[model samples]
Target chain A: MTVVATDETGRATPVVSGYGPSFAEQQPPRNERRSPRRLPRGLRIALGAILPLLLLAAWQVATAFVPAYRLPSPASVVLAGVDLAQRGLLGVHVGISVQRVLLGFAIGAAVGLVLGALIGLSRWADVLLSPTISAFRAVPSLAWVPLIVLYIGLQENGKVAIIAIGALFPVFTTVAGALRHVDRHLVEAGRAFGLRGVSLLAQVQLPAVVPAVVSGLRLALAQSWLFLVAAELLGSSMGLGFLLTDSQYNGRLDRLFLTIILLAVFGKATDAVLGVGERALLKRWT
Target chain B: MTSTTALPVSFRGVGRAFGTARVLRDVDLDVAAGEIVAILGPSGCGKSTLLRSVSGLDAPSEGAVSIAGTAVGPVDQRCAVAFQEPRLLPWRSVEANVALGLPHGTAKEPGRRRVAELLELTGLADAARRRPREISGGMAQRASLARALAREPGVLVLDEPFGALDALTRLRMQDLLLDVHAAVPTTVILVTHDVDEALVLADHVVLLGTDGDLPGATVRRVVRVPGARPRDRGAPELVDLRAELLAGLGVPAHHTAPSTAQLSHQETA
Candidate 1:
């Protein structure tokens, strides 16, 4: 029986030809698209470039039919970007937006993790804080602009605060839920051996919830970017949001398209970085 | 170390209840130092609850449980438990999981050596560097046993440790368990539902059954297996004993002729 099974999978080249390729040949080849692991570095890069190239081609074709003033060509957007780069305003705006995102994300995630632990670990904290947070979360990110600007007098603090507020809820909810629902058997096993309170939490509970928390952090990061525009809308002198508004006020379709594209690239880049870090950290456990 | 000193365990009038339901009632048993005892019963008979109380993971609501004359508290360092699931940390390698069984402040060199010794004893030395996810089910279970024995605790409590394995693996694990017992000689409290397993591994077999009057399951009887280490599975004495245990479990065991291990299935059918 074992010999027949082996022959069917391994050496029976023609007997099961109607069933498609033998199991050995069915194994993915080095450069097959589905088996990207063994693909050469240049081919992998070309594969990644295909979708953006197609999208750019479609946009360029669309621009020819649309009114030039209403929708600028991709080449016009590139020219506008070059024009901004000559004046150095593009670098300053991009740097400022990145700075705001970093500041807001760090503060929001730290507080979210602490608050999540507080509510998750204690019934009293959950009862005292969760209702107010839920209520606050119901208000839109745009709605917070006036209140934050009024409180902080329309400075970087107000902008950063709105982003932080936007980032908090997802991180808080994910971490709290994950920590609350950790595997009880793992805890029992930890304690059954010599693990005590803090040690048990450090060795078992914290590691178990880390994957969930990292995912929450990723969601919070995307939220921070979404609120970046609304955050800077509350009176700002510099940033991608300010540049976007300035380009719209002057009716520079090319500049507006360029700024939007820049935001997309920035958001995608940051998310990819976070994903890499998460994969590295979770590699040992999952 | 304290683990080298085998500890006697005693339960006196122990009873436990959860909210309105009582799960164990007036349960009492005494296990001598270094003896192997198996608790056998049908489902919902509170066999697991009794083992949990012994490990101090759960408290008996009515009476006290003592280990070597000391009352069990919230955590009993003298006992190490290997639950049914391997329960190894996916993050840690097999050797590291076993090292967790060592006392927290154990010196680095001694702890490493002890973990290595346990890995060797459990036949997991080759797989020590592998994480829990990378090993087979039987290998993972063996690693769990290695962890439980890492601290050299006086009492080793296992809650159906081999219940999750395939038949061949389970038999191999059972034999490996006996080999481990011969080498270490710690008092073992094995909770199981398989009659043949209890007979093969234990010095004494306990049956827990619930009565209408009692709030929880109580010990029905204790049968002492009359043989030495590495006992014969096909012995006539064990055949009768298996029949007797089957009868106690309410399975009709009228087979007086030479019986095989399939007696339970035949009787139930």
Candidate 2:
């Protein structure tokens, strides 16, 4: 056990693998392989549609048990939708609401990305700004209506600002948190490959935070819709929110029910689209 | 077209501590150009810290480490490392992951060719577009090695690069590593707890330990592996050497004496 040897007598012999050589040339399996348990396209579509049809049946049955004026039947709601569409009001209101949400969301997400990067990358920015933003975040989005109207009047700018404000916090919190806690080994790998400063941040840190940031965007998108309703009720004359308020005020229960269903459908549709896009973007990582 | 001038790595009175717990203390070792040195020690012996110091991932608290006579910083571009975890970017394809190892400002054509060369060498050319989660552990590790080699470093540091693989995969990776080293000669410092791995791959083995009542881990013994790179796995000398290494790591070998018979039985598994 105590025998100490040196290279003086340990003559070098060229090392060769005991496995000899590649007996046959090996090839890696193709990258086009799909998941083994995938269901057929038609079956998948059928499976996805079953629950919604059941929910629609339940809604129709519930209308039979409730008062007609309070809870409109699905048939009556559809008739009201047809009436509004015949008058060309449905398209105008829905289009206006959709535009506001998209514009507000774009602005909010851009601001959040910049602010989150600053806070996440620099200690000084986090210490100086995070506390104040957190305090403001605690206030409900509706609470700012009076102040907003007072300063800016009941206009498109004020409504869009409300939606932006509602959407901002989630994106900011997630991006900063994700960047701060990225895997240490990944960072080390980046450094080993000679990445530093801005290149490291752009190539490694940003990509690592993408999954979390996207989830945050989804949450912000849903919040924007909620805020849009409140903002429109406070000030606007044309939007899905306006139709809901107008119908409720005039006791037009069928129109009210139609507007509510339309909002729900729009929200669900947008969420589904976002989910699909996210899956496509992160197919490799997930 | 990177130079293959094998860099000599030297540590002089090197020490490292986290707050107050000193891990490595007053260590001194030199690995010659193109030689493979394995750092072997028990769980708390700071073998990984020693490797990290050389790669500049972790700075030494005292003394200095130099490669080719140049002192290293916290991020040394002259050396590359492969870790126990493959640590591939989940967002990147295998080919892109390998390409990431190219130094900044490297022209596009050369980098692309180097990545393709590495993928071919590592047997990953066909799985080039596959993502990390889509591959097996062995494939991921092979990609990691390719990424490290894409840097064309003068020194390669591997911190238990095959520690996570199954036994069969580990054996294959060892053979693959030998083939890689032969094809592109570079100084290698491999850290491992397995005595067999150290003996099989290294030209010299450095056993780190706390000499009774010592404050931190230091080089307790430096054993020059007898024979060449592809030494017979069941050689009598290697069997004795394995037992010696186990004893050096404080494993009691009472029931199993170092012999050719024991080596064969161990290898069969």
Candidate 3:
């Protein structure tokens, strides 16, 4: 039978000769094609800045009409930040919170990954462990603070334990779910090729879920910050959370706003670092 | 690479069941060393189940499958399978995916050399560095075949390896499989639905279907195709066999010439 070739214009041309058009000849220059056009980086950044800039302007306008003790001006919040920095308290609070988050996140995520893999790969492990873990996950984050303090006794470990509890569930849930749903066909293929146990987990199952693991870690990081605030606000003497409570008690609204801003900035900064790693991982894995 | 002898495969009253439903039953067949055999059947006829039994990916509820005189174990190492979906690891480059099939404990250098050679054999050398998602379906299927060959398996199991490709690419892949068999001369057990594919490739084409009211499929008929490797697709003998195979598969042979129609009727009877 004669082959019919369709040109770009949608007209069919009959081919009477040898082989039909080669795959290379039929394919568009896909490598040279770029994704849909996007705004330039500088313009995109400027566009993103518009709302925050408008909020700052609105805040400045509000300070003129409202009482300074209630709603601090942006300049006064900056000045309060400077006051803390001058006294060396700002660095200590920020440093302490960051250290807590990083340590708790590392320990929690590592445990989550191990437990998640176990539950995911084994039916017996999942049956035995999942019910209890799910029930624990249902408990509110603040509910753990009292227990943590009672057990670990209001020390660095208590705060870290609280944060660790916050961080564990997201990583555990995502990793278990992702591993459970990893392509059965791929796993079967790997098995047919002589892979089993640890080799199968490393070579096939784990790599398949790298994207899920990264997203889970990002969620856990956010949870760590939330739990850190809960821990510090309840019992800690020095942290961003402590600064927030101390400022409110002393009628230092400016310092409270400064602490809130620092938390937002640091939370976003850590997430952004994770985002960079995610991009690299997706490039390599996906 | 030195010429490695292919292993013989034997099945004795093999059967498989998932819960209460039986998919295959009471089948017996023997494949000589270095021979090519095709299992052709209708959809849901347990063709893949039979092939999986050879690779030890699935065990028969009754009877046994032995390779080279040994009963097959779970995840048999002597056989390699190329499934219908290519099944290349999407995260890995084509070259790395092929290397994954190397026998366990193969030294790094020798494994690399074997993968490179199979890549060349499958005409995937150029796309070796590309991820499976970056390549076309046909190219990905070639990578799958290359990975299977990298095992240097005693029996190469292909479960509809080209069934997903377009018609033109399928025809090309058929020829490529022939070339691969010629190069390695390893025992190949190919499962496919296409009558032409089986006729063009296998030394013996085993037709699998239910016998009257049997609950599960077994070997219905074994048609030994009469031709050498790379047989002409449109040859009169192949066309006649194709009509007969289709008739056995329950398709009407009314469109064929009168004499072939009579032949198919008699064969089905």
Chain A only: TM-score per candidate = 0.82, 0.82, 0.88
* Residues B215-248 of candidate 2: C-alpha lDDT, one tens digit per residue: 7899877889998776666667887888876777
Candidate 2: docking tier: acceptable
TM-score of 1: 0.89
In candidate 1 chain B, what residue range of length 10 has the lowest lDDT sum?
B260-269
| Clashing residue pairs found in predicted model 3 | none
Clashes in predicted model 2: 0
Q: Judge the docking of candidate 3 as incorrect, acceptable, medium or high.
A: acceptable
Structural similarity to truth (TM-score) of each candidate: 0.89, 0.89, 0.92
The CA lDDT of each predicted structure is 0.82, 0.82, 0.85
Query: Per-residue lDDT of A1-286 in model 3, one digit per residue for the tens?
Result: 2121112101111111212234444233344334568778899899999999999999999999999998999999999999999999999999999999999999899999989988998999999999999998898867978877888987899888888878888999999999999999999999999999999999999999999999999999999999989889987789999998998899999998999999999999999999999988877775
The list of candidate 2 runs beyond 4 A from truth reads A1-68, B255-269
Error (Å) of candidate 3 at residue A181 is 1.4
After superposing the true interface residues, what Cα RMSD does each candidate give?
A: 12.7, 10.1, 9.7
Candidate 2 lDDT, A1-286, residue by residue in tens: 3222222111121112322232112222323346668889999999999998998899899988999888888899899999999999999999999999988888888888888888888899989998988888788767888898899876999888888887887888888888888898898888878888898898789999888888889988998999899889986899999998899899999999888889999998888888887877777454
| Error of model 1, residue A145, in angstroms | 2.2
Report per-candidate DockQ. Answer: 0.20, 0.26, 0.31
